[model samples]
Target: MPTTTGMKGGGYYDANSREQRSASQIFLPWLEAAIADLPEPPPHQQSWNLLDIGSSEGANAIYTTERLITALRENSDLPIWALFDDLPTNDFNQMFLNLFPTGKSVIPANDVYTAAIGGSAFGRLVPPASLHVATTFNAIGFFETRPIAVLPGFILPMRPNPQAPREGVQVSEDELIPFQKQAHQDLCHFYRARAAELAPGGKLLVQIFGRNETHSTGHGICDVLSDALLDFVEADMLPRFFYENFIFPASYRNTAELIAPIESERELASAFRIEQVEARDVPVPFNDAFTANEDRAAWAKSYTGFLRAFTEPVLAAALPDGLPQENTIEKIYHRIDRLLQDYPDRYEFHFISIATLLTRL
Candidate 1:
């Protein structure tokens, strides 16, 4: 499988295909519920306009449009305009074009100029006070941190501290605190900027990843490995290797931590009101056929492609100069493979996520 070396945001989304699938399932139901709560469409202005932020491959956009159309078919005059926006690096335009070759039911608009979290207004794609609704799935959380490790190759001059022992590189309390503060600031900026574009009475639905206190068997192994890797860095066992190879460079914030930034954003305070906030534990089950036949090996290999893409480079850059890249890769693969092999019957992966429905006041 191809790695995330050239992608933006350190290829965080590139890992774990299951994560995307899980997000899709979770968001679809929430969206349906939100739409149902809205006032009935006006007879003269039966049209609805939707903007999807961080629409990676446009699959979610397409799926959402399809569901809305099905639900509102009684109003034949109701027209839907769907806009899929993402970073310029994302192939959203191509994905939309391919999916809607005829361009009959779907209108594809690209809003790539704005940053994921915040930036200039999207005046070109969305006129002032024109959008009826906006939705983001698993995207808003990214603004919490600006993966510093993924900076351009030219900016690679700042190497990891070398004074630490071979076992791990020591990161001072000073360094860690600043990093956390910056991440919080970035997240607040993102929410405030997003709140500005929303039209009064419009709805914004967001679902994002969050940190939880509990850990599960499916995720425990990977979490332990992540902790071990961090330990190695603190000991200076391999400073450069640790910095380069860590995939999930940013940490997940718990529900309270995630809510604080949005609630405190100055721009969002006056215009947007939180309508509904819901939290749930969703466990994704692997396909029954794959597990029934005991083809756990294939499932693990397929799933690990995303995991490796996310973690390999980060791990490689953080290890000591002497650690072989190929060996580390093999070790990660073998560890995951063994886990799957040992527990072939069922592997339940749980995600604790928040769904917030914000209405423009």
Candidate 2:
């Protein structure tokens, strides 16, 4: 199976991405403010390019880009070309359909042209100095490749499982240094790549699941999944190696980690000027509804479906090649469903997000 960092496709991500959409919406004002600050393109420039780097299935991206086009039009009639980019393995067909919902350019009336590019954003995918604005939402947490083969007892390197069988074998702070280094490296590479793509004075907005002083993203959801995987291992339904080797291909960085590269790296500091860096816990829609109605069953399913949309792709890819992938995925998610339903309080997810707005120098 091809290693993929993209979300689950077939319209699933777009359908079940309420949490992501909510978190992304929190930054819209910041994005608009950044757009307002954008310097007008040179006199010879033909059009402005707005790019979404990790636009999975293009639902949220389409809406966000349309708003951006509308915002830009308020100032100038610059024809805007909006680009949605993700992994080559991502469901580009679904993205395109969403990009042009009426079998034609939905935003043609606004002079907004849309297209999808399939590639890794960690590498340069667009012409140098050609982009005007770029945004990456809930995607920078993912590693370009699996950093480690085995992370005993926990899928997320930062969050340890207290109920793990090999208690002390769980990942430790000292062991996480390498992973921290990897996160730094990944961020730096991403910045360098965007630096090459964006014009001077271009705006870049980046938002990803993150950790704050008190809260971290995927708290309840990942913990429950880890417990379920441990249960599978104990039942001999899955080999111990599978449990140890399986890891969510993402990392949640704190505020310090998120801005370290620009603060410390000479090249990054010179290439971009940081406008804002903030981290906070965004409200979860299902969590809010559950808080009001106390509907365990509905909340459980909603939470699981939301998690599965972004996580199942990585989990399914990690299964042993000969195994029944679909059956295994079904079993794993079913267990998560049951666990959430039974002990709803055990997994209250927190959506901690870190966002930064920067301008190319």
The most accurate candidate by lDDT is 2
- Per-model tally of clashing residue pairs: 29, 0
lDDT of each: 0.50, 0.82
For 103-124, candidate 2 gives per-residue lDDT tens digits of 8877744667777888887888
Query: Model 2 clash pairs?
Result: none
Displacement of the residue 112 alpha carbon in candidate 1, Å: 20
lDDT of 2 at 237: 78
Candidate 1 matches the true fold with a TM-score of 0.65
Q: Candidate 1 lDDT, tens digit per residue, 1-361?
A: 1112212233233334455456545756655665655555456654666677666555445566556545444334456666666655555444555465586435333321111221211223355555567776655544343444332111111222221122332334444454466556655655555565555677777666554556322243243344344444455543544444444443344556555665776566677777766655654444443556657776666445545544555455444556534475466556656655555433334456666777777
